[model samples]
Target: MAETITIEPITRIEGHGKITIILDDDGQVSDARFHVTQFRGFEKLCEGRPYYEMPAITERICGICPVSHALASGKACDAILGVHPPEAASLLRRLLNCGEFIQSHALSFFYLSSPDLFLGMDADPAKRNITGIIEAYPEMARDGIRLRKIGQQIIEMISGKRIHASWVVPGGVNAPLDAGHRQTMLQMIPEALEIIIRTLALFKKTLDQHREEIRTFANFPTYFMGMVDEEGNLEHVSGRLRIIDAKGHIVADAIDPADYREYIAEAVEPWSYLKFPYYKPLGFPAGIYRVGPAARLNVCNGCGTALADQEWAEFREIERGPLMSSFFNHYARLIEILFCIETMQGLLAEPAILAARVRAVAQPNFPEGVGCVEAPRGTLIHHYRVDEDGLMTWANLIVATGHNTMAMSRGVLQVAKRFITGAKITEGALNRVEALIRAFDPCLSCSTHALGQAPFTIRFMKTDGTILGET
Candidate 1:
């Protein structure tokens, strides 16, 4: 008889999810699905709240990317109030984003995925974790911890708190970058730059050994989307949207993020709470595309910083067109950290960053607003509709992980088919499947924000694979 294999509470990811693989009577894999098992309706929850409170309220979506949420929410609130933050505020916001990228990416690549890369994928489950990494590669593990700390330190220095900071507000941040904090942040950059350089070298050295993994881990063609500056350099804050085809051709360029509905649409699946977003013109699954580190590199013309630009060129050389495999996200993340460090150093060196006029006082001047930013994971968008009194009537958030849902689901099937040939499966094969999802570094808690009642069901089953009851 055919059977179903389920990997519940998929490990090494930010939130809860599971993978179900279906087998044919001959024990051949037939289908697979990735199910995001938890849901927190931040959009719905924000209804009726004051629009100005959005920066703090919506940021509760995920602890890992709270800075991203706060920034996006702040931008939308900026629009609602019809005011622009001072130049110093803009610079500080971007600087904060750099810190967020470093910390979040370090956590993804080191604490979560590094074990599989260092310790074998088939290593005992208990040992295939951060503790094992610490035991085996003490120096490298310390580097990861230190790098993440520097990032959080930058945040604390700028906003008074690292996570869920209320400093980011409607018109601008609550305070300006002081001279003391500026010097401290600048001092930290050198160490950050050093760590990233060595880590990049170490990772490159090991690439040859993971050839089989590189070949199978979500290595498929799909459109890519990300934010880019006017010169088409990789941008994390305040830029227009760019979508490139798998062949590295620009299908859409300089799209006003406010017009996202014109180019993007969301669809629902019965088995998962996460909504699948795709390029609108192509429609549904056919419009499937990817976002985040790999996609960001694929869409940008260059990194705009010296060291990262050189690495970016070398990375692109992997394919004449855009790199398709999500596995490269790991490599792309390291490059981004290099870019962030360099970018932060430049921003802190600017004298105007210490200006005290950081905020613009304003009342609600618009009833609708939208904001966009490149979160550590990918592009994050926040849209809001408000009453004349400034109370939120409705809101929607398109998180980075949500944008990649289709590709991830399809990737699970591809990996499952490649490794599961019979009823019996190896532990390594199962891990490779989970590792495929890890490549995207999904924050499931931030993605599953359905507006209304989402499709859900409960089923009780026997140990022998028989369904006993349903709800």
Candidate 2:
């Protein structure tokens, strides 16, 4: 008889999800699925709200990346008002994003993924957590904690709160960067850079031990996407979109984010609430592509910083072409943290960072608008249609994790087939399946916004396990 194995509430991730593995009669793995089980209708929730309220409203979607949501929403609102924020405001916004990337990446790498790296994957479940890491590797653990604190402190200094700060607004931020805050942030940069540099060196030493994992965990060809500056360097806060194929060839360059629909489209699956977005030219499942740290590294020409540029050059040597394994996302994330810290240091030293003018106030001048940014996880896009009175009529958000749905689903199957050879699977084998998803570091809460009507069914069962009916 065929059997199904389910791992509920996939551990160590930001939101709720599960994995299901089906086995053949011979006990061989047949298929697998990664299911996102929660749904928050953020798009529909903002329909009747005023367009200016979007930045505040959408930031509520996820506490982990509220700054990302706010920035994307603010940019869309900027377009609706038909005004541009001052150059100083743009610089400040980029600085805020730097804080977000450092903290978020720290959480993903140190607290969540490091346990498996430091401890063996087959280690006791009771001991495979941050507590275990503290007991065994205290110094690394301390570095992780300090890195996240530094990131949050940077956010609070600029926006007055660590999470979901309202400092970001439609045309610009609510206040300019204070001189005291600038000096304080600049003082913290050296320590931030030191921690990431040391951590990256430590991480590189462990790569050889996980070679099997590196090869089996979603190691396949696909397209990559991210935002890039004019010279095609890595960009997060603002830039044109760039996409490259698995062979490191640029299939599209300098795409206007406002016209995202021209090159991208969304599809839905009945099993999961998350929508699958793909390159429109290829259509549906055939258009599968990836985003986030590895994708960003693969898509961009360079990091545009001293240390990071050196690291990026060495990172590319992992393969003849773009790194294909999702496992490399962990390595890519460390390099990005290094990039963010170095970038912040330069931005803070600028004389014009403290300019008094930070905002531009205006009413709605356009009926439709779009905003896009490279969120810590991947590319984030917010689109809006407003009425003459400045009230929102429709809104669509394509979150970072949503863009990787198809690849994640395929990855689940790949990892399952490689590890599970019989009906009685080992705990470590199960952990490998979950570990694959962690490599993507998905934020299910932010990605589960459904478009149109999502598929839903309810079933009643008898005590004997017979289903009554499902609708």
Q: Rate the local accuracy (lDDT) of all candidates.
A: 0.88, 0.87
TM-score of 2: 0.95
Cα miss at 80, model 2 (Å)?
Answer: 0.5
TM-score for each candidate, following the candidate numbering: 0.95, 0.95
Model 2 pairs in collision:
none
Q: How would you encode candidate 2's per-residue C-alpha lDDT over 347-399 as one tens digit per residue?
A: 98887789999999899999999999998889999999999999999999999
Per-residue error (Å), model 1, residue 212: 1.5
Report residue 68 deviation for candidate 1 (angstroms): 0.4
lDDT of 1: 0.88
